[model samples]
Target: MGKEIDSTITFQNLSQKNMSFEQVFQHIITFMKKDPSGNFRLMFGTDSQVFNHYTKFITGIVIQQERKGVWACIRKVTVPRQMLNLHERISYETTLTEEVVSMFTKDHKEQLINIVIPHIYKGANFTIEGHIDIGSGKKNKTRVFVKEMVSRLESIGLKPKIKPESFVASSYANRFTK
Candidate 1:
């Protein structure tokens, strides 16, 4: 948000927009791939608690677990084509831990968070960065790639256990661009 005379130049919220769910999921997956160091554990939860909580939360909504365990949980979540948020995003990467990680992941349980995280970042424009790929390419084509991947998943009847709800304007994560 920026001040422009009496009014402020604001970033638009596209949460209620029309879009594909695949693109959103892809972003999250890409980010997870970058989690080679395990720092991402903070984003989801302590160890595997996020997965368990995810199953419990969406149990009756998108899934009905025949059996449950600690290793993994089968649950359903909304995978929208796109989304938008109108709040200020907070810096929460290394600072995150088990407690808040559990809450954020659960709180925004419905969105395809981290799906396209490789591209939609907080400081993408102001930095030189390292050898980045995928997200930095033709961004408009982002949706095309995502949908194709989703089509493949659907073909295998593989539900990722995570889904995001779409909107009319921007394609966002579970809630804020966390």
Candidate 2:
């Protein structure tokens, strides 16, 4: 048989545990179905922290309804050794975010978009974004990488967001990295 995705790979939030990606998508669908006319934003972002011997990375997936709240979950991955290099860690974080975004194939995106298509004229919208932990602020060490990393996210069809605007990475995922 062809290689299959590991069942052990799961995303979790406060109320759920060990949920597969498909399960998470179903939850997103159910949430959207409840208010199809609302504008929505699906965002994914990753942040990492280096412990003594290993590095921890957490990626957050958030679905937000404008003027409404959000339903979010996170997936964690660990590297065997600490990653001290700034560029490498940032790149890896972006890669992790890309991997999660890739899971939503064209058809999956279409399904989400369809839910709001009919209400588009009424101001309903569905947008997907990739949040990078780096920023372009002069005082930021990650400033040098802003161009390259943002370009990388753009290549994958995401509206790239960074630093302060990237709360999913800087705030949500960062919280669990510690």
Candidate 3:
């Protein structure tokens, strides 16, 4: 077997203790079950902060319960700096989001549960939105790759969110990376 990648995740409201991905998923299910209305959105996003010799990557999951409230979980990892260009950084961020979504969706499919989002008139039981850090603006150099990133996400069947709308990445996760 391949060597495991060491990592830890902490839920903002749950506890500071480290948790595996499975444990995090269980918590999400419990949170969703608490409200029979089932109107909630699960959003995942990732952001990175480059230091002198290393880069810190933060991946955040935000669960919004239709204005009831919000809960978030975050995982952080650090790696030696690679001096990645803007394109590489954006690509890496998207890859991280995709990995987390893939894990959640795979399990969600096996253990099907009906999630009712009142606003969503039709389709799947729930939706996972991927918040990309790249956005269109004069100050943001990452804007150039927004279309490519969005297209990649769409090809994999994930709804993409950018800047202003992608607070999970630009706001929530960005906080911890700092």
Tell me, by lDDT, which candidate is best: 2
- Report the candidate with higher TM-score, 2 versus 3: 2
Model 3 compared with the native: what TM-score?
0.82
Q: Candidates sorted by TM-score, descending order?
A: 2, 3, 1
Tens-place lDDT per residue, model 3, 19-93, is: 777677777777776773656678989999988998888889887777578768887767798546878888988
Q: Which model scores highest in TM-score?
A: 2
Give the Å shift of residue 74 in candidate 2: 0.3
lDDT of 3: 0.76
Query: Can you give the lDDT of residue 33 in candidate 3?
Result: 65
RMSD of each: 19.3, 1.8, 3.9
Q: Number of clashing residue pairs in every model? A: 28, 0, 0
lDDT at position 153, candidate 1: 30
Give the least accurate 10-residue stretch of model 2, judged by summed lDDT.
Answer: 1-10
**Winner of 1 and 2 under TM-score:** 2
- TM-score of each prediction: 0.17, 0.96, 0.82
What would the per-residue lDDT of candidate 1 be over residues 1-178, giving only the tens digit for each residue? 3222212211122332222222333333444444322222111211111221231111111111112211111122322322121110111110121122222232233333333244445322111001000121354333333444334334432331111211100221222322
Candidate 2 residue-wise lDDT, 64-97, digit = tens: 9989889999999999998999999999999999
Assess candidate 1 and give its lDDT.
0.22
